[model samples]
Target: MSFLSSNPRLTQNEGLAPAYNSQSEQPFAKPPVAIESYIQDLIEQRYQEQPEASVVCAWDGDFTYRQLNNLARSLVALLSAQGVAPEVFVPIYFEKSRWTVIAILGILHA
Candidate 1:
């Protein structure tokens, strides 16, 4: 016999599982916040705490937050000029290197 069938209480109360009703009262609702604002705050914190800290380290070279941000902006401009839509998923397949870190940051910025 099945495990639930072995326990009568489990079988009888199976339909009483927690259900989410949008029309009903919500106890966990919170104010909405912009993701970009959060990201900017994190970036600012990193810069202020460790301005020279290596944010991306790879086989080729390591990058500080300043470098990564600059590279990401350059990449965003280049991709935008080439008609790369913000909604597009640009696939990046490459070996581990500084370029990989740049690509990851670039995608996030895009």
Candidate 2:
């Protein structure tokens, strides 16, 4: 048995992530999730599920899940105030650091 499948033939399907799903299963079985709910879940998971988990460890500093989620939520508020919505693209430009990770999640949550 292979890591991806019991059949070694799966090796031939490299570069395709969809190969992991068996053909017996529907391609889109799960129902669509609302953007608000998805963002809320992401924030809640980071803040509530594992608040102490370190999400970013930069040379200058570090941030825990709670901090990142809080920053993300704040970004969400700012974006919402600016009338940003789903399907909208937010530009991200930041140097690699703890703040960068927080900014990425913040933009994503927004």
Candidate 3:
């Protein structure tokens, strides 16, 4: 089957992500996760479920969920040490790369 047939949410939502379902074993299955849910929580869940899965593939390198989580956590610690407050906007300027992905996750998690 084509990707659309295998993952109907793409067609159903017109490119929006499918709701995360905790009870479903399949990664793509529909669940009741709110669209406004914290991005960190989603990443943590994905990290827990598939630590070795690739979360980023950039010109520099491919980074797995485990690496992404670890790097993001490190950034979080650094931000905390620097007294970065929660909900504060942390602007990131970079050409898209693996580090950019890590920065975004780090800022979201910080």
The global C-alpha lDDT for each of the candidates, from Candidate 1 onward, is 0.71, 0.72, 0.81
TM-score of each candidate structure, all chains considered together: 0.55, 0.56, 0.65
Evaluate residue 52 in candidate 3 and report its C-alpha lDDT on the 0 to 100 scale.
Answer: 99
What is the per-residue lDDT of model 3 for residues 1-110, given as tens digits with 9 covering 90 to 100?
A: 58678786652354444453332337555666668667788889999999999989988899999999999999999987887768787888979788998888888878
Once model 2 is optimally superposed onto the true structure by TM-score, how far is the C-alpha of residue 14 displaced, in angstroms? Answer: 23
lDDT, candidate 2, residue 40?
51
Candidate 1: residue 107 lDDT (0-100)? 68
Candidates, ranked, TM-score: 3, 2, 1
Residues forming the 10-long window of minimal summed lDDT in candidate 3: 16-25
* Superposition error at 34 for model 2 (Å): 20
lDDT sort, best first: 3, 2, 1
Summarize candidate 1's per-residue lDDT along 1-110 as a digit string, tens digits.
57557665753345343553441246457656656664545775786788788887777788898887778779978887877776888899988788886786676666
| lDDT string, candidate 2, 1-110, tens digits | 35546565644455356655453256577766657566556667667778999877889898887777778788889988998777788887877777777666666666
Candidate 3 yields a Cα-based lDDT of 0.81
Cα miss at 2, model 3 (Å)? Answer: 28
